[model samples]
Target: MIQSCLTIRGHLSKSLTTAKLINIRHAHSGIIDPLQLKPLQQEGGLLDKLISAIRRRSAPAVWKAYTDLKDSGKIKEVPIQYHSMTLQSFRLNENGYYSSDKLKFYKKCISDILVATKKAQYKLDVRDYNVLLRLYGQSRDWKAASDCWNEIKVKKNEESYNLYMQAAVQCKKYDEVFKIFNKMNNDGIQPDVTTYNTLIEANGRMGNVTEADKLFRDYFAPKNTENKSTSIISKYFIKDANLSTYTPSAAPLSRCIPPPNAVLSPTTDTFEALIDAHGRKKNTPGLNYIYKTMLPQYDIKPDLKIYNALIRWYCHSGDIEAARNTFVDMEASGIKPNVAVFNHLFRHEALKRNRPKVAEAIIDYMRKEYGIRPSTSMYATLIRIHNKHNREDEANRLHTIYKALKSKKLEEQ
Candidate 1:
């Protein structure tokens, strides 16, 4: 019996060894799998530098040796300062954004470098804001963004103001969003519908529904008989530009305005983002504020996005009934509910029976008011509930329900 077992083991080991040899040969022949190397666009940059360092900057002698430094001729064409900035700012994890682990490392490395060098103290420029805020937002470090703003706002520029708003939201800084908005206005930058919307949206994120609602009415509403800060927008956006700088042609951060009245007319896209963000943050009060203040004042009305934010927020808040109610409210207010709002309802708020009749009401509203079809997420949630309760039949039936929804969707298409 022992001899038979040894023979069998020997044969199995040989077979496995053969397979490994074949794989090695294939790799050497350049028949290697395509997935092994990431797509070309995703490669290059930081990884290239690391590879060079790992290879000791020595090539096969057939290929050119890799070097981190720029060639003399190439260096001549580029501006010295910008080039240094680009190199210094290059993350070792170029596009490590695709992988969460790598991104965390990338952020940590940058933070370490910043702290170790105390670079923030020496140079706090717009480009620096761009890099840091982008990193912070990507990591949802909103407070860091706000702290960065506190350091720079007194010497603030318009670009920093815009970025600070985004970073603040990522870090969940509702108050800073408004604070920066107010500061920007006091600086004489014109506030538009988008700006007002972001302010309201940030407040909503904290579930400060009342404060969000009140602030919107008082500051953002155009005809907001209540808003005391309507002029705050125009006043702050241009404040420093008008009084401090004499060179308006220079970027605001340059603080090099030629004369007063240096007005910056930001595009409508900024305002649209505010609207979308409000919907995301579920700041219903902010939405109302925008409806009253921006529609007539800036001629900006609520779009699908504004409604989507409220609905999605309600959905995420796990109030299926509230989500559905908002869906109805938006339609009544003349806005349409989109697929995202529907998806979020199932994803975030899908609780089952004995919880409340809220889920049913939302489903009913979606059917009756919008005529929009339910999605897989809703059915899946039902399946989850059924399984949790050990109701096999109900879970099986929920699968059938999903199948029916899928079929109907295909038919309509």
Candidate 2:
């Protein structure tokens, strides 16, 4: 009996040692970390092949490898990690700019994978559906997003609802937003702050000011009680804007005093949405209403986005002076300008071409001051502008510079 016990212990030790040796071999072969970039030469089995395919951003290759393994009886069930990595690869392929045809192809790839997982009864996580929902939203394919919503076997959470709401809103399906919200409430799920913000932004996007205001007043308004006196005006505004309540800044109104006794306060993003909504509709009065009344009550400072929105509205209004003043105010507030701000100025110059020198100067300032290398779109626009003005020489020179820059980038890669 003692000898048998000794033999069993020896065998267990041998199995562990073999595993260590195999891991060491894989490590030396440079396929140790799955998450890191695989070596130029990777040596492993089906999992290694799948990772390689994912790293290459070949959804077709990934799908084929997965199926081949499944058919060969090597992998009985698709691992959750495999699904996640594959989805991540799809997201990587998104690459910021995708044509409608490319988007359609990506959607099909995801749908096929989802169908396979469902057939195998492999439980899907919300993350998987969330990616698909976002893609559908981008593609404006609300029908597929709705179908995905029904495919979830597990109870949905706030994030799931948010994705669906965003998808509906992206497609301008305002009615669908309310429908999903109602379903969420019916399921006894409480809407988070994001849910209300999305609803407000969606309504504001459609110029449904009255509806947006009602939604805001219903959900985000401070809770009231019979014991204390509460005024409707006070809910959205401070009694007075005192200097003591202000944070000192060169810009106009750095911060305001928040209202008292508010349980759920609206965030800066909420007011940004409101401002954006009014801005889109050219309802300057509505923007003033939020800036002077609603924002002060919430103590939400106008951040870079708010300033950009104001600048954009003014630019669209052809009030370049107003836009310039807003840009100065943004700088005064100590918020450094981003590429968006510069792009707006560039776009204005592209359209007007009144002062091509001003556009060139702005580009210089962006490059020298902020170190913002102009994007390809910016160069293209400038070149087109020069061409429009019959400055073929200038256009050709800029085109040459752009090509050289692009070549440098590729060589670096």
Candidate 3:
């Protein structure tokens, strides 16, 4: 009997390990593999199933598990951490504005769990609020984000306002951005670099060039202007900016902006925003000046993002040679290009110039140098390019290879 028990235990251990691997893989793909749930179910119970489902990162799977547990009256058996884990899973899964529905579903989960917490008198913490705030920001649900902001009972911090402002920017509510900034000042919360960066981006995006430039000069510019005071409040709370509508006490000379915190050095994001502003307006001279001259003067090392911006601007301005040179310089600078960079290059060369060879070279270079596997879009684009040029054999061969790789990936999952 002892030997038999040991043998069973060994098999169970292997099964559990296999199950964990499957759970992790499938969860990342946003779908739980039903076959992998057996081992976890046998070893544990509802919580284990819920955990496995959350690992799949599928909203429906998690909600199903949650509902199952709740219906079976076993939800109370699940620990608070499990609920928090679900919240965190949702928070971390936010890739961007593209996944708004999933984010809304996650928001619902948060609301349901919060109700449960309240009923059970489970004490919530700031991280919970932060995660919810991040979700709201990513979803661009300005009203929901505002509600979450106003509902925070604890002392509001810079991060809270930053998230709110981020959501407002996504909604293009530039007026709301200033209102929040003023409220932050009134609440005694000093705006940080992130605050200023988001505000600048919002203004630039709305074609409010004057606002963006004023903020840049007042805060991020290497040199200070005579008309603008160094104080944050004086610069932002001026009568002419119409920000005083939010705060009656925020007069032109109200001294609401906090004192300068040392000699402010602009972050990489500051330059990126400036460059984007110019790029959007097709102000190539201003964009080039900032990229070449202003950044070096501030001793700011240009990263891949800056390089990508320059490349994109060049591409837009019909300077393919300059864009190619910038791309080479970026690689030389030890800043590796991400898939987005490659995609930008591929799209530009293939669609704009109809030179599919450039894109094909990019594919080879990316694969050889970075060891980065071609994504589905990459394969599709290559096939399309070949077909467009009447290279039917090459297109078919690429299609076959893509299918084989996709089948293998599915098998692995």
Candidate 4:
């Protein structure tokens, strides 16, 4: 295997050496006229065919050909082609690991690809900018993505719009989502169902119910008459909330927002997800309305999954008592407490507050009523909470149980 790897490396080295010998004409600037350069046209002789191929937009075939010729030491003597097409390809390829740190790499890629396309003397096309926009979004460098967005807004691209949709999720540039939405109109880029779904999902997660509702109504529902507005007004039912309640970032709401239109009955799964999102948003009235209206009017049966969702929302919204009540309702409805439901209860009542007695009570309930043994998770949760609160005595107790369980697990293995 080592010998084969060495052989492969040697061949690549030789390929690079040959490529360096090629006399590639520096690609032109801005955009090149692939049409005017008849030699670069496909109908032309061998050289022209090569040029046309390389100039094709996002032409992996052309890129490969150029690479091959360059490796063979031919480009030094022949000219390359550039057009809007090449730029599009460059942009499309920039879609990985673009966290906040590597914004510069995305920019460099755009510039270098643009330069290559120009040297090939091809016309710049809208696709190139679209590709760049997507790359910027993948990078999660909102600032850079915003720049690409402004430049490409004149001619909208699906890739760019998609990036904005994603960037809006983790970054503070939600306006970019709307910007692309508006760009759709000016650039004649129609918003497909996917686009509307993304917008609705994003807005709902951001607690921008107004915007989410508007998008849903305009595109998803167009006829539902409901109170719709995009304000953090967490106070519809109980105005004058302690505004300073729980760290006031949209992070929780964002986390809670369901993926728009989960592939379920349009009225059931989808509405339930949105209602759960509102619960995460901590909009009491919104939660109630969804339970009262969305389920009843829509004829969606309230099932175990719905109950679990409500339990989760109540906990996430900091309504501990309500969460507990919902848990009871779920059991009364004959829904066995799944691990997830129990985990949420433990997290809220015990882990969140280091309430050991509460944790013990939950453990007793699981054993006595549910006939569920305290699994590794139960032991781990207790250990972690006790450790965090510096309750060393309690930690020792849980640690003993955890160790015994670990021993049993290993024995079974």
| Candidate with maximal TM-score | 3
lDDT of each: 0.47, 0.64, 0.65, 0.55
Give the per-residue lDDT of model 1 (tens digit) for 191-253.
544454455456445543333444444443434244443332232121222232211221232
Error of 4 at 298 (Å): 2.6
Tell me how far the alpha carbon of residue 56 in candidate 4 is from the true structure, in angstroms, after superposition.
34
What CA root-mean-square deviation does each model show from the true structure?
Answer: 18.9, 12.6, 11.4, 13.7
Q: Candidate 3 at residue 74, lDDT?
A: 72
TM-score of each: 0.42, 0.65, 0.67, 0.45
lDDT of 2 by residue, 274-357 (tens): 766666666555655676677777777778877777777666656677678778878887988887788888778766656666
lDDT of 3 at 36: 37
Q: Look at candidate 2 and give me any clashing residue pairs.
A: none
Better candidate by TM-score, 1 or 3: 3
What's the residue-level lDDT of 135 in candidate 1?
A: 64
Q: Cα RMSD (Å) between model 4 and the true structure?
A: 13.7
Q: Tell me the tens digit of each residue's lDDT in model 4 across 181-298.
A: 6555556665555566556555666555554544444443424344444322233434334332222332343333333443223444455546644665677666766666667765
- Give the winner by lDDT: 3
Candidate 3: give the clashing pairs: 27-55, 27-56, 233-257
